[model samples]
Target: MPSQPDSSQLNNGSSAHRTLSGGGEMGALMRTIDWAKTPVGPVEKWPHSLKTAVRILLDCRLPMYIAWGKEFTQFYNDAYRSIVGNKHPAAMGISAQETWPEIWSTIGPMWVEVWQGQSFGFDNFKLTIERFGYPEDCYFDFSYSPVPDDTGNVAGVLVTFTETTEKVLLQQRLQASADQLTRIFEHAPVGIALLSGPELVYEFVNEPYLELVDHRPVIGKPLRVALPELAGQGIYESLAQAYETGQPYIGRPQMLLKRGQPPTLQHCAFEVVYQPLPDQQGQTESIVVIGFEVTELVKAQREAELANRAKDEFLAMLGHELRNPLAPILTALNLMQLRGTSEVERERTIIERQVRHLVALVDDLLDVSRLARGKLTLKKQRIELAEIIAEAVEQCSPLLEQRHHQLELQVPNTGLTVEADPRRLTQVIANLLNNAAKYTEPGGKVTILGERLDDEVLLWVRDNGSGIEPELLPKIFDLFYQEQQSMERSQGGLGLGLAIVKNLVGLHGGRVTAASAGKGRGSEFSVWLPFALATQAEETLEVIPNLSQPGQLRILIVDDNMDGAEMLATSLSLYGHTIQVAHDGLEGLKAAQSFLPDVAILDIGLPTINGYELARRIRQLPELQKIRLLAVSGYGQQEDRERSLEAGFDLHLVKPVDFVDLNTALFEEQP
Candidate 1:
């Protein structure tokens, strides 16, 4: 039996102190503490098991501790000091119950099991502890093993632990982020899909992506197998490239053939992006696909293109058909001048003026068509505004006089110069003046006013006539738009004049606007153009030298219109030139070779062989190789002129051709 030490001996710190030389700060703390006042009494009276446990705990680098004796007196190493935080120094010699009172309910049962000779371990065990002056949730991986006394009975619990709070919380945050991303992808409006492996298996697809493919069961299926219609459409190739190169691939809007629910083939357009998702090794592991459907937009664009093409074709045909009949009427008028008596001179003059007016209307239709297609080009130059106004007035004089309208012109003679295409600008003013003349009642007053307004020139045409309604003002400039007219269309003009005016003005870098005081009042149109600095160069008129009459030469005239051919032949015959007429291309070719004519005037649209083929055939004849070729046609579009010139015509002339121009073509130098 061991005798109890005296109170003096118990209080003697040097007698109880062990030689704990290797431990750091905690070791020093242990040696300094007066264990005589503690539940475990002095250290010297400790059992061998507890003393050995203390030695093991102090020497360890891992966080370790010991609870010895029935009161559970706490002992710990330097590595465990940080876990105790601000309570470390005082907790060094205290009981475990006081050291971790906040977590005693959780850990107390485990300690009791260890006391009963049991060993236990836990991974990520949770506890609430007050380590930093506040109760905080923490996690730990730890084990509790029993230590035996000299009597071979369990007496204490030795604990080895590691704080796992940071690691466990980090894992939880990562899982939460993944869940949020999944929710975002699921609800996205545009198609989103994820594919994995070289097989490009559908790993995930959002609602939109599923709807895009008609809600097919495609998850876990390869992309090629799931959407077989995309087999040869370059979609699979693009995906492969993105995956292999580890670079993102952007797909432009393109037509795609899709298999619909009824197993019908349908056209769809899609714009997509394939982004490669790389692994830890920086190698492409999966691809994320995002796409938008644009089928309706693409379809509308194609339909619009087709409609424009149809419109152009229709206008070209209309121009050709309208001019064919007018050609002969003008030719007959010229024939009358060459051969008729003076008795019907007044009637001929009236017929000729009306024919010319009809020609002007046809020209307006063609001009508007060209402008709408962006094919009309301006020959811009510096010109006086008065000169343009004078030419426009002269063109509109016939209409103005026939309607018995009063005209008032007020424009400054100088200081109103602008850079503009003279011919187009003349057309613009003429169109406005014509509109004013035609729309106003007979003898109504029309006014032309011009002035310089700051940096711009202002010109306006005002009319006291049947003014436009307020609602119709905004739409008057739209092509072919007209207000409610009589069923007979008594106005007798296509609604193209104002549209041409607007387009031509726009081409000149100017703008035109219209105003009216409602129906039955009056209307005014204003044009604004940027003022240009006048140049010092004097305007010169082109002098067309009088052409000397060619000596009598055999001329062949080929036209499908018998009246046109005969009238043109008679007109040339009056000029002392020998003429032969042919009604078709084959007859014309024969006449060129047989007559060996000095010139051949060929009309296109001939029967049997067209004029172009006739020209080639005539050129092939060795005897007629020197004969000059002239093309006459009502189809006078730019492309028609180019085609005629390409087919070897020395000159291409539009119908209602003047005899003076014909004579010039006959003797002018050929290029």
Candidate 2:
């Protein structure tokens, strides 16, 4: 069935060497092997097809081998030497089963199929070989092709192969990296999308991005087509600009209308960004869009603005209406006192006290509003702590006397100075004292203590009155918060005093805190202010002297309220000054020109024209230019004061003015 080599071929190694010549390293090894001891016998007696296949394998650069005859003996070239490792010269003439015994179970059947005239091949085929003295898992692209003899019968198996282990592993690693990136994009918090090409086609849309556009099917569709509502909104234009210039476009909160049922417009706001993505060639290729929905935040801000505007309007109206009535009442009381009527003197005093209390309530309401809006400005000056304490004591004396509360004062006489707004500081101290007096029983004791502690000045107000409940301690300084009181509401207040105290103290770079053991156990409030440096000079406090005997001068009073205007004219007339009264701005303007008055006290909300315009018209008259303009109105907000000054007023005073303050305004020199 097979040919065998003659005796000469078996003994001669040189003839076998000639047959395996030209292959690199394995060629030389094959030449020295003794072929007679192998299953295929000597080379000279081998089948013609076997010998021809060996010559072809030795000369080829690709890895190749031949398993011939019944033993399935092996022959391979230099390209296949590394594949067999140390099994070289010995394996040159060994059976395929012995050469790869570790993987024979897998490849042995393949050889049988080839021997039966069938051919087989595989790409990235897995196999375990022991050619290196140990087993190693490897992959290869290999084939088993049958070889035939001169009789055309299956005679041998020819195998061609190349290692593919490294290539396969590299591909697996790249796939893992891609999967990780996909996961990150899908779960991002902000809306994200990738658009490709000049048409701005949506290449990728994450879940957040889908929800931003009302969950419409947008992927693979152009942006213009996906969001038709954005046609004239400049969004599509912005993306195009980013792509063309390779620059990013950042957008602030912009209104976007969503599609909804009933054809009603559902508006929302979004902050968006479009960044251009560049290709390797340094050209813009696509755009990355990132968006954050700000509709709720924007809505909240708008509502806050509207609320503030409404509050400002209400406060203005309340001040004007309330102060209009009180102005005449207070002026009438002053006139009664000036007239020196002993009869009904006690009644007049009571009316004056109640009217002043109402004025304080109105002021507290406006002050809290200004503080909440951060519109109040402080005029800070260096002053001794003792001076501030004395003034606060004087202001609280009236309340303390009414309540019959015993008060104690404990404070350092000197070296405890602070840079602060004197008026605001006095208000803070007075509010604490008033709170203690009102909440305490008639015979309760209240103490005010002050001291210097480590770069700060500490003041404490302790009251042996109705102590605070533990649960309500923290919220005592909240605006409009009041303790539950009897139906009579003996503590007459709007509960804004403590809130004003806290805000004013904070503005001066200080802190305040309240503490109480429990209800009926008395409460203690502490205030700490940063001590001013000793090197700073202390400012001398100016006393507002009485202007009862001020020199007579021409004065004009203009107001829409007839009673307020007439009473103010009578008060100034009693000061031995010439007075003129006008019920409207036009009449006031005409009166100022004809009278050539030294001062014009004008109300803001006047008939015909407002005070601001009246002041402007007065300033326009060349002859009346030197006359002093005073604004007396209920609108005492900082902006209202600024507006009065802008309109050429020398002074801006709130309504229900004190007689002494009015006298000072009439006599004191303007700044």
Candidate 3:
């Protein structure tokens, strides 16, 4: 049997509790059992509400600590028990810092607040610990409330919490999603922005939108500070309408502003979608406005429309201006040729030249269209500067002789070479010289000079002629612009000569300039061209020559037009080749076999069998295969030459061919 415990130690234990019991209806009930002498034990005998409350607090999903003097206790519900593992019971009955030292720094202050009877709570609190010997960082929402004694003083703290790891992480994830979407909106191309509030403050602006005026992060700024150009444009009023009605407003492409010297005008198109931001109660708090800009595509479309209109007008005027003078001049030349040795022959030659000038003018107008559409291409080769200059001088010889001008030529004997399209370069130089001769008085001096300078070759045509006026010199290269009031205009050109010269030179990666000591003193036009370096220079010159020996060998001439074939065949027979003329390629092939001609002249456009196909068939005949095949056609582009070579022709010549060049080609040796 056990001895009785001391009564004085029991009386001291529950003195305060007995005092409260005396004032209540349970005071008489406590006296019979000596309430002051009750022993301290586990809280299993607490009232239902107290037990349920403590149970609820202990059952929380967060790790908790409660301390009463020296007796410290820790509890982890199902959620937090996993964190401590085998250390659960040992983790209990210890100070929070001793059990989870890593989290004690933050937990210490929260415990003080709870013990002092102040309620405390925190959301998304980070808890890092190694309680069970593994490190972890977790999120939690925690709260502490005091558990008061019957005397109304706090005796213990009720730590209540939820392991808000998922909730805290989920909330942070939502914020991160919002931030990412905001970044995309703020940097999108073509001026994206948001407008908010009644004052139209800019809530956000993207990188591109800010670059429209060179700023950074246009957040928290008034719209007017950046774009005062919007005044009276009704933008703000429209935004007010959108904000008030919760409906979107759209803006079509319109003029925005102008800036820069030579001041460029800006145009923009935009549409805004207005949205109402709401609270949890669904009440509107603010408005969101979105904007988008489109300008370049609209400008391109408008320019294309204008160019189409200009081309149509240019073609119509060109036809009327060119064809009107050709009829009488052709008729007079025909009559003069019939009376071979007459004074009328001289007059007819003048008429013929004037008619050719008109034809050239029409050709230039069409060429402008071709150049604009990227259709103009060149036939380039390494050529002698002297040869090119001589050709140009010869072409302008009649004009020089007509004006009685003393034309001089100066070029290096060793040959300064230029990479160029030969025929085009000849035309360019001839136009300059002819214009000088036309404007100069009789007996005026004209000189053509070529000199190598550094890596380039420069050619100059200078004349003691009536020069360009100072006012018109700037526009001399412009199409159809002439200095009509000056002596330079007496030449009566449509002003296309210099314009074509400039374009042709540019195509060869060269440049040209026209200069004069004011009007009438003199004028000089200089062309600068890149010359081939010695390493890449051509070694041999190509010459096309007529037969040097007298030729009575049989020749076959094929053309689609009867007159064209007969006339060419007759000319060849006079030059002493046994000639056979055929209007179609099929007949020409038959004549070629019968005559077994030494040479064949074929037109590319022929009925029944095309010249290319007939040439292929002729090559198949062993007897006629060795005979030369020359393609003659009005199609003279670079592509035409390539096609002719592919179709087995030895040479390709454009129509209305130069008789001298043809003669040279017919007789020239292959080597």
Which candidate wins on lDDT?
2
Q: Candidate 3: where is the Cα deviation over 4 Å?
A: 1-144, 147-152, 155-344, 351-384, 406-422, 441-443, 464-466, 469-475, 478-495, 516-522, 531-538, 542-549, 669-671
Error of 1 at 388 (Å): 2.9
Per-residue lDDT tens digits of candidate 3, residues 177-219? 9799788777665566666665667777777666664454457
On a 0 to 1 TM-score scale, where does candidate 1 land against the true structure? 0.74
Report how far off residue 566 is in candidate 1 (Å): 4.4
Across 132-202, the per-residue lDDT of candidate 2 in tens digits comes to 57877788999999999879998888999898877866766687786776678789899999999999999
- Tens digits of per-residue lDDT for model 1 on 274-384? 999999999999999999798998888889988987887777777777777887888788778877757889998999988887887888777877887887888788788
Please count the clashing residue pairs in each candidate, in the order shown.
0, 2, 7
The number of the candidate with the highest TM-score is 2
The regions of model 2 sitting more than 4 angstroms off are 1-191, 197-201, 206-250, 256-268, 273-285, 292-297, 534-545, 669-671
- The TM-score-based order of candidates, best leading, equals 2, 1, 3
Q: TM per model?
A: 0.74, 0.78, 0.53
Better of 2 and 3 by lDDT: 2
Candidate structures ordered by lDDT, highest first: 2, 1, 3
